[model samples]
Target: MHFLRYQWEPYLSYGQLFEFEKNKVVYHQGEAGRGIYYLKNGEIKVTLLSDKGDERIINMVPPGMLFGEHGIHGEPYLTSGTTTCPSLVYYFSDDVIATICRKHPEAAGIYTDSLIYKFRTLAEIIAHLDSPVEQQMAFYLLKLVQENGNASMNQTAFAKYIGTSRITVNKIIQKWKQKGYIELHKREIIIMNFDKIRAIASNPHMD
Candidate 1:
Protein backbone atom coordinates (compact mmCIF):
# COMPACT_ATOMS: atom_id res chain seq x y z
CA MET A 1 0.00 0.00 0.00
CA HIS A 2 3.06 2.29 0.02
CA PHE A 3 2.16 3.11 -3.58
CA LEU A 4 -1.08 4.65 -2.25
CA ARG A 5 1.06 7.34 -0.64
CA TYR A 6 2.18 8.51 -4.07
CA GLN A 7 -1.20 8.15 -5.80
CA TRP A 8 -2.82 10.68 -3.47
CA GLU A 9 -0.15 13.35 -3.92
CA PRO A 10 -0.23 13.95 -7.70
CA TYR A 11 -4.02 14.28 -7.51
CA LEU A 12 -3.92 17.07 -4.97
CA SER A 13 -5.51 19.37 -7.51
CA TYR A 14 -8.66 17.25 -7.23
CA GLY A 15 -9.03 17.09 -3.45
CA GLN A 16 -9.09 19.27 -0.35
CA LEU A 17 -9.07 18.53 3.37
CA PHE A 18 -12.19 18.84 5.53
CA GLU A 19 -12.75 18.42 9.25
CA PHE A 20 -15.89 17.63 11.26
CA GLU A 21 -17.02 17.17 14.84
CA LYS A 22 -18.47 13.99 16.23
CA ASN A 23 -21.89 13.06 14.78
CA LYS A 24 -21.64 15.62 11.96
CA VAL A 25 -23.33 14.65 8.76
CA VAL A 26 -20.97 14.23 5.79
CA TYR A 27 -23.55 13.53 3.07
CA HIS A 28 -27.18 12.48 2.74
CA GLN A 29 -28.78 9.69 0.81
CA GLY A 30 -30.06 10.72 -2.62
CA GLU A 31 -27.91 13.84 -2.50
CA ALA A 32 -25.54 14.69 -5.31
CA GLY A 33 -21.89 14.16 -4.53
CA ARG A 34 -19.38 16.95 -4.99
CA GLY A 35 -16.90 14.08 -5.14
CA ILE A 36 -15.67 10.96 -3.36
CA TYR A 37 -13.81 11.06 -0.03
CA TYR A 38 -10.68 9.50 1.45
CA LEU A 39 -10.77 9.22 5.22
CA LYS A 40 -7.68 10.46 7.05
CA ASN A 41 -8.55 10.14 10.73
CA GLY A 42 -11.31 9.24 13.20
CA GLU A 43 -14.37 7.14 12.39
CA ILE A 44 -17.50 7.56 10.25
CA LYS A 45 -20.88 5.85 10.19
CA VAL A 46 -22.28 4.85 6.82
CA THR A 47 -26.00 4.07 6.98
CA LEU A 48 -29.14 3.54 4.95
CA LEU A 49 -32.46 5.10 5.96
CA SER A 50 -35.74 3.54 5.03
CA ASP A 51 -38.89 5.31 3.85
CA LYS A 52 -40.40 4.26 7.19
CA GLY A 53 -37.69 6.11 9.09
CA ASP A 54 -35.60 3.08 9.99
CA GLU A 55 -31.80 3.00 9.85
CA ARG A 56 -29.16 0.29 9.68
CA ILE A 57 -25.47 0.36 10.41
CA ILE A 58 -23.82 -0.31 7.07
CA ASN A 59 -20.20 0.02 8.15
CA MET A 60 -17.67 2.25 9.82
CA VAL A 61 -14.99 3.93 7.71
CA PRO A 62 -11.62 4.38 9.38
CA PRO A 63 -8.44 5.88 7.94
CA GLY A 64 -7.09 4.70 4.58
CA MET A 65 -10.57 3.76 3.42
CA LEU A 66 -12.56 5.43 0.65
CA PHE A 67 -16.11 6.56 1.28
CA GLY A 68 -18.74 7.80 -1.21
CA GLU A 69 -18.29 7.37 -5.00
CA HIS A 70 -20.87 4.60 -4.82
CA GLY A 71 -22.22 5.81 -8.12
CA ILE A 72 -19.35 7.38 -10.00
CA HIS A 73 -21.42 7.84 -13.14
CA GLY A 74 -23.89 10.57 -12.22
CA GLU A 75 -25.75 8.45 -9.67
CA PRO A 76 -27.14 9.68 -6.37
CA TYR A 77 -25.78 8.50 -3.02
CA LEU A 78 -27.57 5.47 -1.64
CA THR A 79 -26.55 5.98 1.98
CA SER A 80 -25.82 8.93 4.23
CA GLY A 81 -22.40 9.37 5.88
CA THR A 82 -21.81 10.96 9.27
CA THR A 83 -18.81 11.32 11.51
CA THR A 84 -18.91 8.94 14.45
CA CYS A 85 -16.26 11.08 16.13
CA PRO A 86 -14.09 14.08 15.39
CA SER A 87 -12.77 13.28 11.93
CA LEU A 88 -10.61 14.66 9.16
CA VAL A 89 -11.50 13.70 5.61
CA TYR A 90 -10.25 14.46 2.12
CA TYR A 91 -12.67 15.48 -0.58
CA PHE A 92 -11.90 14.90 -4.21
CA SER A 93 -14.03 16.74 -6.71
CA ASP A 94 -15.56 14.64 -9.45
CA ASP A 95 -14.10 16.60 -12.30
CA VAL A 96 -10.62 16.61 -10.82
CA ILE A 97 -10.77 12.89 -10.08
CA ALA A 98 -11.79 12.23 -13.65
CA THR A 99 -8.89 14.29 -14.92
CA ILE A 100 -6.48 12.43 -12.64
CA CYS A 101 -7.72 9.06 -13.85
CA ARG A 102 -7.14 10.15 -17.37
CA LYS A 103 -3.61 11.34 -16.56
CA HIS A 104 -2.63 8.52 -14.18
CA PRO A 105 -3.86 5.03 -14.95
CA GLU A 106 -2.43 3.27 -11.88
CA ALA A 107 -4.81 5.16 -9.64
CA ALA A 108 -7.63 3.23 -11.25
CA GLY A 109 -6.26 0.00 -9.80
CA ILE A 110 -5.96 1.42 -6.29
CA TYR A 111 -9.47 2.81 -6.43
CA THR A 112 -10.82 -0.50 -7.67
CA ASP A 113 -9.18 -2.43 -4.83
CA SER A 114 -10.68 -0.05 -2.28
CA LEU A 115 -14.12 -0.36 -3.84
CA ILE A 116 -13.98 -4.13 -4.08
CA TYR A 117 -12.95 -4.49 -0.44
CA LYS A 118 -15.97 -2.45 0.63
CA PHE A 119 -18.26 -4.46 -1.61
CA ARG A 120 -16.96 -7.72 -0.21
CA THR A 121 -17.46 -6.54 3.35
CA LEU A 122 -20.98 -5.46 2.57
CA ALA A 123 -21.67 -8.91 1.17
CA GLU A 124 -20.40 -10.47 4.40
CA ILE A 125 -22.72 -8.27 6.47
CA ILE A 126 -25.65 -9.28 4.32
CA ALA A 127 -24.74 -12.89 4.99
CA HIS A 128 -24.65 -12.10 8.72
CA LEU A 129 -28.26 -10.90 8.76
CA ASP A 130 -29.27 -14.56 8.95
CA SER A 131 -26.48 -15.46 11.36
CA PRO A 132 -27.01 -15.83 15.08
CA VAL A 133 -26.73 -12.44 16.77
CA GLU A 134 -23.92 -13.63 19.02
CA GLN A 135 -21.90 -14.82 16.08
CA GLN A 136 -22.56 -11.54 14.33
CA MET A 137 -21.37 -9.66 17.40
CA ALA A 138 -18.33 -11.83 17.73
CA PHE A 139 -17.34 -11.44 14.10
CA TYR A 140 -17.80 -7.69 14.22
CA LEU A 141 -15.64 -7.32 17.34
CA LEU A 142 -12.87 -9.52 15.97
CA LYS A 143 -12.75 -7.52 12.78
CA LEU A 144 -12.64 -4.23 14.66
CA VAL A 145 -9.81 -5.43 16.86
CA GLN A 146 -8.01 -6.36 13.69
CA GLU A 147 -8.65 -2.95 12.13
CA ASN A 148 -8.58 -0.29 14.91
CA GLY A 149 -7.30 -2.61 17.61
CA ASN A 150 -8.64 -2.92 21.13
CA ALA A 151 -5.97 -0.42 22.16
CA SER A 152 -7.97 2.58 20.89
CA MET A 153 -11.60 1.46 21.37
CA ASN A 154 -14.15 1.09 24.13
CA GLN A 155 -17.23 -1.02 24.83
CA THR A 156 -19.70 1.63 23.68
CA ALA A 157 -18.07 2.03 20.30
CA PHE A 158 -17.81 -1.71 19.96
CA ALA A 159 -21.54 -2.07 20.64
CA LYS A 160 -22.32 0.61 18.06
CA TYR A 161 -20.43 -1.25 15.38
CA ILE A 162 -22.18 -4.51 16.23
CA GLY A 163 -25.57 -2.74 16.47
CA THR A 164 -25.97 -3.84 20.08
CA SER A 165 -26.01 -2.19 23.49
CA ARG A 166 -22.94 -1.62 25.62
CA ILE A 167 -24.36 -3.90 28.30
CA THR A 168 -24.58 -6.69 25.77
CA VAL A 169 -21.08 -5.93 24.57
CA ASN A 170 -19.81 -6.20 28.11
CA LYS A 171 -21.49 -9.56 28.57
CA ILE A 172 -19.87 -10.83 25.39
CA ILE A 173 -16.57 -9.45 26.55
CA GLN A 174 -16.98 -11.22 29.86
CA LYS A 175 -17.64 -14.50 28.11
CA TRP A 176 -14.58 -14.05 25.91
CA LYS A 177 -12.51 -12.94 28.90
CA GLN A 178 -13.36 -16.06 30.90
CA LYS A 179 -12.40 -18.07 27.84
CA GLY A 180 -9.04 -16.29 27.85
CA TYR A 181 -9.63 -14.74 24.44
CA ILE A 182 -9.55 -11.05 25.41
CA GLU A 183 -8.43 -8.76 28.19
CA LEU A 184 -10.52 -5.63 28.89
CA HIS A 185 -8.77 -2.75 30.56
CA LYS A 186 -10.43 0.59 31.41
CA ARG A 187 -11.04 1.71 27.81
CA GLU A 188 -9.16 -0.78 25.73
CA ILE A 189 -9.70 -4.45 24.86
CA ILE A 190 -6.55 -6.45 24.42
CA ILE A 191 -6.90 -9.51 22.27
CA MET A 192 -5.12 -12.28 24.15
CA ASN A 193 -5.56 -14.97 21.57
CA PHE A 194 -6.31 -14.30 17.94
CA ASP A 195 -6.95 -17.88 16.92
CA LYS A 196 -9.39 -18.45 19.79
CA ILE A 197 -11.12 -15.16 19.01
CA ARG A 198 -11.48 -16.20 15.40
CA ALA A 199 -12.86 -19.56 16.48
CA ILE A 200 -15.41 -17.87 18.74
CA ALA A 201 -16.40 -15.56 15.91
CA SER A 202 -16.97 -18.46 13.56
CA ASN A 203 -19.54 -20.05 15.85
CA PRO A 204 -23.22 -19.89 14.79
CA HIS A 205 -24.71 -19.72 18.30
CA MET A 206 -26.66 -16.57 19.08
CA ASP A 207 -25.72 -16.65 22.78
Candidate 2:
Protein backbone atom coordinates (compact mmCIF):
# COMPACT_ATOMS: atom_id res chain seq x y z
CA MET A 1 0.00 0.00 0.00
CA HIS A 2 1.24 3.49 -0.80
CA PHE A 3 1.96 5.61 2.27
CA LEU A 4 0.26 8.99 2.17
CA ARG A 5 2.77 11.89 2.30
CA TYR A 6 0.57 14.62 3.70
CA GLN A 7 2.09 17.07 6.19
CA TRP A 8 0.20 15.86 9.23
CA GLU A 9 2.68 16.78 11.94
CA PRO A 10 2.34 20.52 11.52
CA TYR A 11 -1.42 20.25 11.76
CA LEU A 12 -1.09 18.16 14.91
CA SER A 13 0.14 21.03 17.10
CA TYR A 14 -3.08 20.69 19.09
CA GLY A 15 -2.43 17.00 19.62
CA GLN A 16 -0.56 15.43 22.49
CA LEU A 17 2.82 13.73 22.04
CA PHE A 18 3.46 10.52 23.95
CA GLU A 19 6.44 8.21 24.22
CA PHE A 20 5.89 4.45 24.50
CA GLU A 21 8.31 1.70 25.33
CA LYS A 22 8.31 -1.61 23.51
CA ASN A 23 5.29 -3.87 24.23
CA LYS A 24 3.28 -1.06 25.77
CA VAL A 25 -0.44 -1.16 25.12
CA VAL A 26 -1.60 1.85 23.16
CA TYR A 27 -5.28 1.01 23.28
CA HIS A 28 -7.46 -1.97 24.02
CA GLN A 29 -10.07 -3.53 21.83
CA GLY A 30 -13.65 -2.65 22.77
CA GLU A 31 -12.49 0.57 24.40
CA ALA A 32 -14.15 3.79 23.39
CA GLY A 33 -12.10 5.33 20.64
CA ARG A 34 -10.72 8.39 22.38
CA GLY A 35 -8.51 9.51 19.52
CA ILE A 36 -6.39 8.63 16.52
CA TYR A 37 -2.67 7.98 16.67
CA TYR A 38 0.04 9.14 14.29
CA LEU A 39 3.22 7.17 14.54
CA LYS A 40 6.23 9.44 14.34
CA ASN A 41 8.73 6.65 14.86
CA GLY A 42 8.93 2.90 15.54
CA GLU A 43 6.39 0.15 14.88
CA ILE A 44 3.02 -0.76 16.33
CA LYS A 45 1.10 -4.01 16.12
CA VAL A 46 -2.68 -4.04 15.78
CA THR A 47 -4.37 -7.11 17.21
CA LEU A 48 -7.90 -8.43 17.24
CA LEU A 49 -9.43 -10.26 20.14
CA SER A 50 -11.56 -13.28 19.36
CA ASP A 51 -14.68 -14.28 21.29
CA LYS A 52 -12.65 -17.03 22.88
CA GLY A 53 -10.30 -14.38 24.25
CA ASP A 54 -7.58 -15.31 21.81
CA GLU A 55 -5.58 -12.52 20.25
CA ARG A 56 -4.47 -12.43 16.63
CA ILE A 57 -2.07 -9.99 15.10
CA ILE A 58 -3.99 -8.18 12.43
CA ASN A 59 -1.58 -5.60 11.08
CA MET A 60 1.63 -3.75 11.79
CA VAL A 61 1.66 0.03 11.67
CA PRO A 62 4.93 1.31 10.27
CA PRO A 63 6.46 4.63 11.15
CA GLY A 64 4.65 7.61 9.62
CA MET A 65 1.36 5.75 9.53
CA LEU A 66 -1.85 6.39 11.42
CA PHE A 67 -3.82 4.09 13.70
CA GLY A 68 -7.04 4.24 15.74
CA GLU A 69 -8.74 6.13 12.92
CA HIS A 70 -12.18 4.73 13.64
CA GLY A 71 -12.50 7.32 16.35
CA ILE A 72 -12.85 10.06 13.78
CA HIS A 73 -16.31 8.70 12.97
CA GLY A 74 -17.23 8.15 16.62
CA GLU A 75 -16.83 4.40 16.33
CA PRO A 76 -15.29 2.22 18.98
CA TYR A 77 -11.90 0.78 18.12
CA LEU A 78 -12.11 -2.66 16.52
CA THR A 79 -8.62 -3.73 17.45
CA SER A 80 -6.05 -3.20 20.17
CA GLY A 81 -2.75 -1.52 19.39
CA THR A 82 0.61 -1.95 21.06
CA THR A 83 4.08 -0.68 20.49
CA THR A 84 6.42 -3.23 18.98
CA CYS A 85 9.37 -0.99 19.67
CA PRO A 86 10.06 2.28 21.45
CA SER A 87 7.82 4.78 19.71
CA LEU A 88 6.78 8.40 19.61
CA VAL A 89 3.14 8.95 18.74
CA TYR A 90 0.92 11.96 18.36
CA TYR A 91 -2.59 11.50 19.67
CA PHE A 92 -5.29 13.67 18.11
CA SER A 93 -8.74 13.74 19.62
CA ASP A 94 -11.71 13.12 17.37
CA ASP A 95 -12.89 16.67 17.76
CA VAL A 96 -9.48 18.01 16.85
CA ILE A 97 -9.26 15.82 13.76
CA ALA A 98 -12.75 16.80 12.69
CA THR A 99 -11.93 20.46 13.22
CA ILE A 100 -8.72 20.15 11.26
CA CYS A 101 -10.49 18.46 8.39
CA ARG A 102 -13.19 21.08 8.38
CA LYS A 103 -10.66 23.92 8.31
CA HIS A 104 -8.08 22.41 5.91
CA PRO A 105 -10.54 20.41 3.71
CA GLU A 106 -7.60 18.80 1.93
CA ALA A 107 -6.77 16.93 5.11
CA ALA A 108 -10.00 15.01 4.62
CA GLY A 109 -8.73 13.62 1.36
CA ILE A 110 -5.51 12.54 3.03
CA TYR A 111 -7.46 10.73 5.74
CA THR A 112 -9.67 9.09 3.13
CA ASP A 113 -6.60 7.91 1.23
CA SER A 114 -5.12 6.49 4.40
CA LEU A 115 -8.33 4.58 5.08
CA ILE A 116 -8.39 3.27 1.52
CA TYR A 117 -4.82 2.07 1.82
CA LYS A 118 -5.62 0.24 5.04
CA PHE A 119 -8.70 -1.45 3.56
CA ARG A 120 -6.74 -2.55 0.54
CA THR A 121 -4.12 -4.06 2.82
CA LEU A 122 -6.80 -5.82 4.83
CA ALA A 123 -8.34 -7.23 1.65
CA GLU A 124 -4.97 -8.61 0.58
CA ILE A 125 -4.52 -10.26 3.94
CA ILE A 126 -7.95 -11.84 3.75
CA ALA A 127 -7.32 -13.14 0.25
CA HIS A 128 -4.08 -14.81 1.33
CA LEU A 129 -5.47 -16.62 4.36
CA ASP A 130 -5.92 -19.94 2.54
CA SER A 131 -2.64 -19.81 0.62
CA PRO A 132 0.27 -22.09 1.40
CA VAL A 133 2.40 -21.22 4.38
CA GLU A 134 5.49 -20.79 2.19
CA GLN A 135 3.74 -18.28 -0.03
CA GLN A 136 2.38 -16.44 3.00
CA MET A 137 5.83 -16.33 4.56
CA ALA A 138 7.29 -14.92 1.34
CA PHE A 139 4.67 -12.19 1.15
CA TYR A 140 5.17 -11.42 4.84
CA LEU A 141 8.93 -11.24 4.51
CA LEU A 142 8.59 -8.96 1.51
CA LYS A 143 6.22 -6.78 3.52
CA LEU A 144 8.74 -6.60 6.37
CA VAL A 145 11.45 -5.62 3.89
CA GLN A 146 9.28 -2.84 2.55
CA GLU A 147 8.39 -1.57 5.99
CA ASN A 148 11.71 -1.97 7.82
CA GLY A 149 14.25 -3.08 5.15
CA ASN A 150 14.76 -6.38 6.95
CA ALA A 151 12.91 -9.17 8.77
CA SER A 152 12.83 -7.57 12.19
CA MET A 153 10.45 -10.00 13.92
CA ASN A 154 11.79 -12.79 16.06
CA GLN A 155 10.67 -16.38 15.35
CA THR A 156 7.91 -16.35 17.95
CA ALA A 157 6.45 -13.09 16.79
CA PHE A 158 6.91 -14.02 13.16
CA ALA A 159 5.20 -17.31 13.80
CA LYS A 160 2.28 -15.52 15.47
CA TYR A 161 2.07 -13.11 12.54
CA ILE A 162 2.12 -15.99 10.07
CA GLY A 163 -0.21 -18.27 12.13
CA THR A 164 2.40 -20.95 12.69
CA SER A 165 4.54 -22.41 15.42
CA ARG A 166 7.88 -20.98 16.44
CA ILE A 167 9.54 -24.33 15.75
CA THR A 168 8.18 -24.34 12.23
CA VAL A 169 9.39 -20.80 11.63
CA ASN A 170 12.82 -21.72 12.96
CA LYS A 171 13.00 -24.71 10.61
CA ILE A 172 12.01 -22.55 7.68
CA ILE A 173 14.65 -20.02 8.61
CA GLN A 174 17.24 -22.74 8.86
CA LYS A 175 16.31 -24.03 5.45
CA TRP A 176 16.56 -20.56 3.97
CA LYS A 177 19.91 -20.07 5.66
CA GLN A 178 21.22 -23.35 4.25
CA LYS A 179 20.12 -22.25 0.80
CA GLY A 180 21.91 -18.92 1.24
CA TYR A 181 18.63 -17.12 0.79
CA ILE A 182 18.81 -15.35 4.16
CA GLU A 183 21.17 -14.65 7.03
CA LEU A 184 19.76 -14.77 10.52
CA HIS A 185 21.40 -12.51 13.03
CA LYS A 186 20.60 -12.05 16.69
CA ARG A 187 17.19 -10.49 16.12
CA GLU A 188 16.93 -9.96 12.38
CA ILE A 189 16.92 -11.85 9.12
CA ILE A 190 18.78 -10.25 6.22
CA ILE A 191 17.79 -11.11 2.70
CA MET A 192 20.87 -12.41 0.92
CA ASN A 193 19.22 -13.57 -2.31
CA PHE A 194 16.26 -11.43 -3.18
CA ASP A 195 15.57 -13.04 -6.53
CA LYS A 196 15.57 -16.54 -5.11
CA ILE A 197 13.39 -15.49 -2.23
CA ARG A 198 11.07 -13.71 -4.61
CA ALA A 199 10.85 -16.81 -6.73
CA ILE A 200 9.86 -18.88 -3.75
CA ALA A 201 7.41 -16.24 -2.62
CA SER A 202 5.76 -16.14 -6.02
CA ASN A 203 5.48 -19.85 -6.56
CA PRO A 204 2.51 -21.24 -4.66
CA HIS A 205 3.53 -24.87 -5.14
CA MET A 206 7.12 -24.37 -4.10
CA ASP A 207 8.28 -26.90 -1.47
Highest lDDT, which number?
2
In candidate 2, position 1 carries an lDDT of 40
Q: Which stretches of candidate 2 lie over 4 Å from their true place?
A: 51-53
What TM-score would each prediction reach against the true structure? 0.82, 0.89
lDDT of 1 by residue, 83-178 (tens): 978998888777767777898987777778766766777787777766655677668767666555444467776665566688987887888899
lDDT of 2 by residue, 1-207 (tens): 435632576576767899999999998888888978888988899877768775657677877777877655567787788999999998988788888888889877777787776667667777776777778887888887876567777888887777778898888889889989899889988989888778877885654
Name the 10 consecutive residues with the lowest summed lDDT in model 1.
1-10
C-alpha RMSD in Å of predicted model 2 compared with the true structure: 2.0
**lDDT score of residue 23 within candidate 2:** 94
* Top-scoring candidate (TM-score): 2
True-structure RMSD, every candidate: 3.0, 2.0
Worst 10 residues of 2 by lDDT: 1-10
Per-model lDDT: 0.72, 0.79
The total of clashing pairs for model 2 equals 0
